[model samples]
Target: MKILFHVLVSSILLVSCGSSKQLNENKNSLTKEINKIYQENVFNGFAVSIVDEKGTLYQQGYGFADISTKKEYTNNTIQNIASVSKTLVGVALQKAQELGKINLDDPIEKYLDFNVSNPNFPNEKITIRQLSNHTSSIVDNEFYLSKNYYLKSNQDLTNVKLNFDEEQVFNPSDMKISLQKFLKNTLEKNGKWNKDSFSKNAPGTIYEYSNIGTTLAAYIVEKATGETFQNFTKKNILQPLKMDQSGWTFQDVDFSKFSKLYESPTTLLPFYEMVTYPDGGFITSVNDLSKFLSELIKGYNGNGKILSKESYKEYFHPQLSATNFIERNTQNPYNESYNVGNFIGYGYTGFIGHTGGDPGVLSMMFFDPKTNIGRIMILNTNFSNKKGNDAFYGIWNILEKYQDKLIK
Candidate 1:
C-alpha cells in the first residue's frame, strides 16, 4: 500500500510539471512571434495588448518613445490611437445614459446649440443612434481631408515635424478656424456642405463612415453634461482606470513618456491636433488601454465596470449589415471590409470596435463578444507599406491574420 501511494503522488507531480512546461512553452512562442514582428523595423514604435474576459494576457511596447532621446517604449508608453479613440467615446456615451444625461434615440440637434440636419431630407432628424452607427448620412468633404485646415490649428504652436520616408512631414502653422467654427461651416444650414455633406440618401438610411459623426458624440457629452469632452472623460473614465498618463491634448501627456509618431523604424512625424478632439485625438498607453479593453471585453460577456448590461447592449449591438436594413452598401471607399455597428464598426462577426489612420499613424482595437477576446495594434506607420503579409496594410493587418494563433 505504501509503495502504491508513493507512485500515485509521483505521477500526479510529473503531470503537473509537464502541464506547466507546455503552458510556458506556448507563451514563449507567442512572445517570440511578437518579437519577430518588432525586429522587422516596420514602424518606429508600437504598444500592444491582448486580453480576454479575465484580463490582460500579454502586453509589450517595442522600440523608442523618441529615437532622438533614446528613451525606450514600454507597455506604458502613451501615443495617439487615431480613430480607435471612437470606442472610448462609445462607452462614454453609454455612461452618459447612466448619468441620465441623454437618450440614444434623441435627435443630435437637441443637444447641439447649432442646427445639424440633412438638407435633402430636412424633415427627417438625425438621431444620436444614427451618429453612433455611422448611418447618419454625413460625409467628409475637402475640409475634413485638407492639410491647410490643420496648418492653422492650435497644434501649429509647436513647430511640429513629420517623417514619412523612413518619410517625414512637419505640421504647418496656418488655420484660422476652431473646431466648433469648422463644424458650423460643415453642419449648419448655411454651412458649406450642409447641402453637399449630406448624402443623397435620407438620414439613417445608409452607412457612410464619418469622423464628423464620432466627434459629435463627444460634443453631445459636453452639451449634456456641461463639461468639455476632455475634462468629462478624464474624471469619469481616465481617473477611474488610474490612467494618469492619458489625455486628449498634447498638454495632457508627459512628453518624457510620450512616443513620437513615426513612419519608419527611425523616422518621426510631427503631431496634428483637432478641435474635434473626440474623434481620434486620444493619447493612451497599453496598460491604460488594456484596463479599458478588459472592461469592454467584460461588457461583451454581459457586464462591465463602467457600462451596465443594457447600456453595453445599446453600445455594441450591430445596427446595419448587408443582410439587414441598409439601403445601399458601397465598397466602403476606404476599406471595404469595414462595416458599421452601434457607435463603432464591426471588426469581425462578434467585434465592435474602430480603426484609425492619419498621414503616418494607423491603429486598430476590437473585442470579440462570443470569445471575449480583444486585441489592439498601433503603428506609427500608415497604410502605404502594403507589401508583405500577402498585401496586408500595416502591423494590424498581419496581427489580425494570426490573431488567434499568435495571441493565445
Candidate 2:
C-alpha cells in the first residue's frame, strides 16, 4: 500500500512539471509570432493587447516611438489615439445618464446656447443618443475646415497674397476659436441660427457622421459636470482605471516626454491643435490603453466598479442599422457601415473599433466583444494617395493575419 501511494504522488508531480513547461513554450511562441509580424510590416510603432474573458493575456509594445532618437516604444510612449477617444467620451456620457446628471433622450438645445440651423434636415430636436450614435444631422461644421478651404481655394496665390488680399483669413493657433466664432458669426449674419438651422433633423432619421455631434457631447459633459471636459474625464475615467499617462490636451501633458509627431521618411510634422478634443484628440500610451481595454472587456471593471454592466451593454449595443451601403474612394479602402459612433466589424474576425487619420497620423483600435480580444495600430505616416485606401486596408490585413493569435 505504501509503495502504491508513493508511485501515484510521483506521477502527479511529473504531470505538473510537464504542464508548466508547455505553458512557457506557448507564451514564448506567441511573442515570437508577434515580433515576426512587426518586422514584416515595417510598422514604425505599435502596441497590442490580448485579453481573455477574465483578464489580459498579453500586452506588448513594438518598434520605435521616435526613430531618429532611436527611442524604443514603451508601454508609456504616448500617441494620439484619435477617434478611439470617442469611445471614451461615449462611456462618460453613459455614466452621466446613470448618475441622473443628464438624459440621453434630452434635446441638445436644452444644454447649448448656440443655435444649429439646416432647413433641409427633418429633425428639430437633436438628442444625446443621436449625437452619440452619429445620427444627428447637424450640419458638418464647415468652420472646422476653413483653413483647408482657404488653402485649397487659393492654391495658386502666394501665402502673403492669399492672407492679405483675400477677405477670409486663417491662423492655425486660433483655429478652434476661429471655428467657434465663424459658426456663431455665420449663424447670426445669415439669420440661419434658429430652429430651421439649429434643429435640422428630427433626432434620429439619417446617419451622417458629424464631428460637431461629438463636440456637442464635450460641451454637454462640461455643462452637466460643472467641470472642464478634461478634468471630468481625469477624475472619473482615467483615475479609476489608473491610466496615468492619458490627457485631453497638451497643457495637461509633459511636453518633453511626449513623442514628437512624425511623417514618412522621418520628417517631423507641425503639431496642429485638434479643435475638437472630444471627438478625436486624447493621447495615451499602449500600456494604459491595454488597461482601459481590459477594464472595458470586463464590463467597465470586473465587478462593475467604474460603469455598471448595464451601462456598458448599452454603450456597445449597435444603435443604428445601415439603411443602405455607402461607398467612397478615399486614402483608405473600406466599405464601412457605421452604427452609433463606432465602425462595426470591418476587418477579419468582425473586430469593432474606430480608425482615424488627419495630416500625419493614422490609427486603428479594435476589440472583439465575444472573445474580449483587442488590437491597436498607430502610424505617423499619412500614406498619401489620391484616395486613402491603402492605409486602412493595409492595417486591416495586418490585423487579420494575426487574428488567430490575437483573438483565439
Candidate 3:
C-alpha cells in the first residue's frame, strides 16, 4: 500500500508539471502573434485582456500611451472606454432594483422633475425598462454630437491640434453643462436643444440607439437611490469588485495614468469630457476592466458579488425581440446592437457584451456563454479605413484562437 501511494503521487506531480509547461508555451505563442500585429498596426496605443469567470488569464498593453513623452502603454494605463460604459449603467440599474430603490417597470417620470414626453407619442409613458433596452423612442439629435463635449478645464490648448469630425466639436471648458441640464435640454419637449429628439415610433416599439437615453436611465438611478450615479456605482460595483483603478470621471481616477487619445498615428487630440457622461466615459485600465468582465461572467453563471442572482438574470435577459429592430446587423459578431439586455448587448453570434467608439477611442468586450471565456481590446487611436479595421480584428482573432489553450 505504501509503494502504490508513492507511485500515484509521482504521477500526479508529473501531470501538473506538464500542464504548467504547456500553458506557458501557449502564452508565449499568443504574445508573439499579438506583438506581430501591433508592429504593423497604425494605432498609437492599445491593450487587450483575456479572462475567465474567476480572473484574468492573459493581458498585455503595447505601443505608446503618450507618444511625445515615450510613456509605454501598460496594463495599468487608463482611458475612457466610450459606450462600453453603458454596461456599468446596466449593472447599476440592477443594483438599484435589488436594493428596492426602484422597479424596472416604473415610469421614468416618477423619479424625474423634468417632463420628458415624446411629442410623437405624447400619451405613452416610457418605463425604465424601455430606456434600458434602447426602445424608449428617444433619439440622439445633432446637439448630442456637436454640443455635448467640452475641453477639460485648465488644459493648455494653444499648441494642441484639434482634428475632429464635423459633429465632434469641443466646446470651451466654461461652456460645460450639468448632466441633468443637458438631458433636460435635449429630451424635454420645450427646451433649447430639442430638435427631432424623438422618433415617430412610440415608446417600447422601436429600437433607437440613444446616448442621451442611456444617461437618462443613470439619472433615474440617482433620483431613486438619492445618490449621485458616480457615487452609487463606486460604493456598489467598483468597491465590491476591487476595481480601484476605474471611475466615471477624471476626479475619480489618477489623471497621470490616463492615455493621450490619438486621432491618427501622428495626430493627438485635446483632452475632453462629455456632458452626457453616463452613456460613455468610463475611464479604466485593462487590468481593472478584466476584473469587471470576470465579475460579469460570474454573474451570468449565477455567482456574482455586487448584485443578487435575480437582478443579474434581469440584467442579462434579452429584452428585445425580432420585432424591435427594423434591420439587424447579421455580420459583425462584435456588434452589440444585434440585441440588447438592460444595457448589456448581444452579438449576432450569441456573444454577450458591449462595444464602444468615440473620438480617438475604440473598445470591444464580449464573452461566450457556452465557453464562459471573454476577450477585450481597447485602442487609443481611431480606425477609419480598411487597413486599420483588418489589423484591429486580426489581433482580436489571435486572442480567440489561443484563449482556450490557456484554460486549465
**Which predicted model would earn the best TM-score?**
3
How far off is residue 185 in model 1, in Å? Answer: 2.0
Regions more than 4 Å wrong, model 3: none
Per lDDT, the best of the predicted structures is 3
> Is candidate 2 or 3 superior in lDDT?
3
TM-score of 3: 0.98
- Candidate 3 local lDDT, 155-221, one digit each (tens): 7676576648877898888989899899888988788999999999999998898898999999999
Two-way TM-score contest, 1 vs 3, winner: 3
321 in model 2: Cα distance from truth in Å?
Answer: 2.4
User: Candidate 3, which ten residues in sequence have the lowest lDDT sum?
Assistant: 154-163
Full ranking by TM-score: 3, 1, 2
* Candidate 1 residue runs with Cα over 4 Å from true position: 1-21, 147-177, 192-195, 265-267, 323-339, 388-408
RMSD of each: 4.4, 6.4, 1.1
Candidate 1 local Cα displacement, residue 343, angstroms: 1.9
- Residue-level lDDT of model 2, residues 1-408, one tens digit each, is 999999999999999888777666665666676576556534566566555445555566677776667787766777676667777887789788888888888887677667653545434666788777766665454445443222222122321222311432434453345334444554432533222223444557766666666767777877787788888888879999888888877667664555545444345554545556677777887677777766766773335457888787777677655552243222222322444432122332344666666545567666666656666666555555533344345444554455454332
Kindly give the stretch of ten consecutive residues in candidate 1 with the minimal lDDT sum: 147-156
